[model samples]
Target: MGCIASKPPIDFSADVNFEHFKLLRSVGRGAFGKVCIVLKRDTKKLYAMKYMNKEKCLQKRAIRNVFNERKILESLQHQFIVNLWFAFQDEEDLFFVVDLMLGGDLRYHAQRSGAFSEDRIRLYTAELMMALVYIHDRNIIHRDIKPDNILMDENGHVHLADFNVAASIRKGSLLYARAGTKPYMAPEILNKSGYNQSADWWSLGVCMYELLRGKHPFRGGTTEEMLEMIQSAPIKYPTTWSEPCISFLSGLLERDVTKRMTITSENVQEVLKHPFLASLDYDKLINKELVPSFVPDKDKVNCDAMYELEEMMLEDNPLHKKKQRLQKTTMSKQEQAKRETIGAELQRIAEKFTVYDRSKVKSTPDVALDTNIDDDEITSASPRPQRASGLAVFSNEHDSSHMSEDENALRGDSDSRRVRSQSTDPDPLELPTRLVTPVVDDGSSTSSPIQA
Candidate 1:
């Protein structure tokens, strides 16, 4: 008998339009857009579709950052990094369909589970180190590396997400733009000293510390006090931590960039060889052979806070704000050509993915049924349904007020809290709107680099 070949998994692609997917309940919301769980009609595959309004992005002058993020994501392919399955645009919005990380973000898990054991922290730290190594090798700096951006999958493995502020660097060059969540930011970044990939190492150290101790290493009631503490306070380790673990953190949290572990090409290898990560096999770790100590309950994909917020939002009437149609204005001939060039590049990238068969998709109904239920009539809480067919229509309005409230509530006073400060730069186009709020502590002037 002849040998038979197993068929490869089908990769379905669709047009750069929202019509192809049935939007479900909102999973998350950001400053300019909302993330929804969308099911592809033709293949029934689920994805977390990040929909950003074109007008809002334009108003905020964040279009460049959006394009840059798309470019970076398209080029990256790694197990520990969030995979961008598709990038498309319609007249009204830009859509990024990515892998649905059902296990939620590390911040949610850390808050729910409390302090993690050394063994568990070691596993997560090792995995994140591998992710950092991958990105640093390509001369890419993930300016933002915090608990919220580290998403866990069903198997308890974590992948780095949120590349909105990531920048590609040339060899031996340093980035001066201050960007990243405040608490996780390194001294060099906070001081506005030109920094490099070593900054991410500092962030990883902060994450490890928080996971083990349940609080940030540098603590203060205000942002200024926090920055002062970061610059001067000695990194105090818990009495329970072993000497090796303390040494490992000390290496990464070095205030002087020159002495920082993983600061140089040669030092990165040395950092990995430290006693704290002795149990991890670098090869196996990168290959994801090491099993995690904690796996989130698969049935509860959304955390309690997220689930509750989703329920509340779904019950409320969808925002009645009229959709703002975008129109090009005050564009010079040169600028117009530049926009066209970028558009063509994005279109080309979109076409590289698998093409979907649109004929199989069902037609949209004239009057979609409103699924919102009255809050008083609520009874048993059911699992989020995976609809076999039919679109769950909802408003695509960008509700900034609701999003701000949700973010504040989800992020308590722990190390994971993201505080915002006014932007120093007046030019909105030069930086994204999210970057305007410098991630910092309560009521202090110290601001972290805004996400560009």
Candidate 2:
């Protein structure tokens, strides 16, 4: 009898790597990296691909935040939050494929579009509260909830994005990291008192107020002056605003945690029944049956065109360039030696990151909620050590127990310790002052020639 013939194993390797997608356009950028709209070759599905350079991450001391962000997102799936679909790493960068919000961020809309109607703001509030209820149930807090972090879809539905600074709090525990932007931060966070999930409620109230007023509730010339406003300033609602609107805002912005309205599993109905959202249909809202008042123009790519221009003109290594060089980057002998040392250091601190695919997992990922890295502002008061060469590496000997408080309380670990100093009021005088693509080859440019 003739020997039976068998097919060799199908190579599924390319499905998860950089080669799997075609770069469509550059959308937006964050402190860590830039996001691109990419089309998956095999599935023909579009996604927002966020790529962060490993070198830049280490240099910025953001690897921990990146790692924690990935772990937190892996376990989360929400309608009102950006959902992660795939995560993988190349030789040079870490990549995340997430739901694409083509309508752009709220910051973009707030600037170009005229003042938002109160009815529309009410709809948005109901949607976001549902999201808050979901995340808080799982013990996670979205520390950043400003207009910049809120994104809109083609149909004008908003989803919260950017988790680099998000924290996971254990039950009954408090978050101490100084991790939010100015003005949007709650009084407790500004005060340096250990804050619970109520902090998120405060931020939401600020957003509700800002969307209607076209300005932040707390304002000053500098962050210092603004922080003072956050601590002691009364939330003054305009006389033109409705009485219910003021009541909803006051409930959320209440300085007392006990009185501050929070959304949780136990209180979901209570939040939905708020006077601001009394008539909202919870089922219709979650099902997206309620028509949004402001729908983005489907014909336009809602992101800033400047991002695409920047990718084409100024990127050191553009996406198309990376596409051509599919082989692993060849490291010099000296660089290889450095990587060897860095590799061991990373292994000791954290496990190797894996390429995660949702289709393969039968259940939620086993990623731990704990970030392991010290987020206590006191521990990080001294900025991560930097080197003149721009290749700063985290020391393998970092000991959390040996940090000494700086004598400068305003800018040092002292800001982090005020919560425990038995002070009821926030320090009034305190304020801490703190990727690319594309190209058009102009004859004036000295950049490497772009190959089609």
Candidate 3:
């Protein structure tokens, strides 16, 4: 038997191991293992514990990949990438304790909103570019970049997670794996001889296309159909997309791998210099000004007092009588249920029409449909499904809240209320407009650093 070894705690030293961690619920599941919400008993810290059965993983020869992932997680630290706290092994399983992304994945949001706004896409793309720049600079190719892998935080900032297929590069290492999401894959990656970091950029471009237009650029029914379409997919610009967005993504989605726009590459710099992100200042962007364009619904964010103020205003409005009348006339329970059932049926039918290349991009794994696990296994640890009912998780707090809420909301107890009357209606528009970075003065001369 392979004995399970546990290590001392990093910060709060209370001897804990796989068995010691409280298993709240299964957040996700797959072929290899399952991800469950676990609580560190002594510290009371919550984490998504990914459990991979060593025997099952070794059978697939994916242990090397798991090892590589652990190595990569240990070496990197960046705002746009998910943080891996620790890796440990037990007799039967390899456990990865990771930061929880309560906000869920981008694919969930994309499905809900029909399509993300151009502004929203810009913000997400910018974060992805920064993460890629950091990843590539360290000679690691993520090999997977898609909406499903991009996890959101309470603040709406995107973190690139899922390094299961990531590879570290050397001078002559072979990169094989006709892997990655089919529609998001670069043509070169599909060939699978080997691909450099440029593949991530091409994928990013595809992600942007989908974010702005609500569908992938290259799509079809079967995997073969998708590969064929991807090979012949045009760089057609949608009329609905903004001019700046179209131009920037066109450069990114170039068929030539060598010419693909990367974050640090000159072509990428040229794309960022475009008018679409003209107001974007990288230094400020990182520090939080020019924040993410798409904030989660305010109801999803915890703005305890701010919401109360809004309610008070609504109560005082002259149209309060009309509002009450409208509420009363709204669909009754039976009618509402009927409408929901019909809507769900229509959505299911529509999904059949919206096909994509299924080059078999990985998800948590094929989950057990039965058993105690729910579809949203990732949230099994939660007390309940937190309905989106607060301020944007990513919005700057006007009033002080000691601890941030869950992925979709923050909870705080404070008596003060900020004036809610002066802001824009949609929560996205109500974000603070201050710039995080100072503008560089063109006339001011500075000394260029001398090379030693």
**Residue range 353-446, candidate 3, lDDT tens digits:** 1211112223222211111112232121113211111201111121012112231111111112112222111222222221111112232324
What's the TM-score of every candidate structure? 0.67, 0.77, 0.60
The 0-to-1 C-alpha lDDT of every candidate, in the order given, reads 0.60, 0.67, 0.54
Give a tens-digit lDDT track for model 2, residues 141-182. Answer: 877787768888889898888877677777787765556554
Winner on TM-score between 2 and 3 is: 2
Name the runs in model 2 displaced over 4 angstroms.
1-15, 325-351, 365-368, 373-452
* Model 1, backbone clash pairs (residues 3+ apart or across chains), number: 4
| lDDT over C-alpha atoms for residue 362 of model 1 | 56
What TM-score number comes out for model 2? 0.77
| Model 1 steric clash pairs | 13-356, 178-449, 179-449, 421-438
Which wins on lDDT, candidate 2 or candidate 3? 2
Better of 1 and 2 by lDDT: 2
Locate the minimum summed-lDDT window of 10 residues in model 2. Answer: 414-423
Model 3, position 2: C-alpha lDDT score: 100
lDDT of 3: 0.54
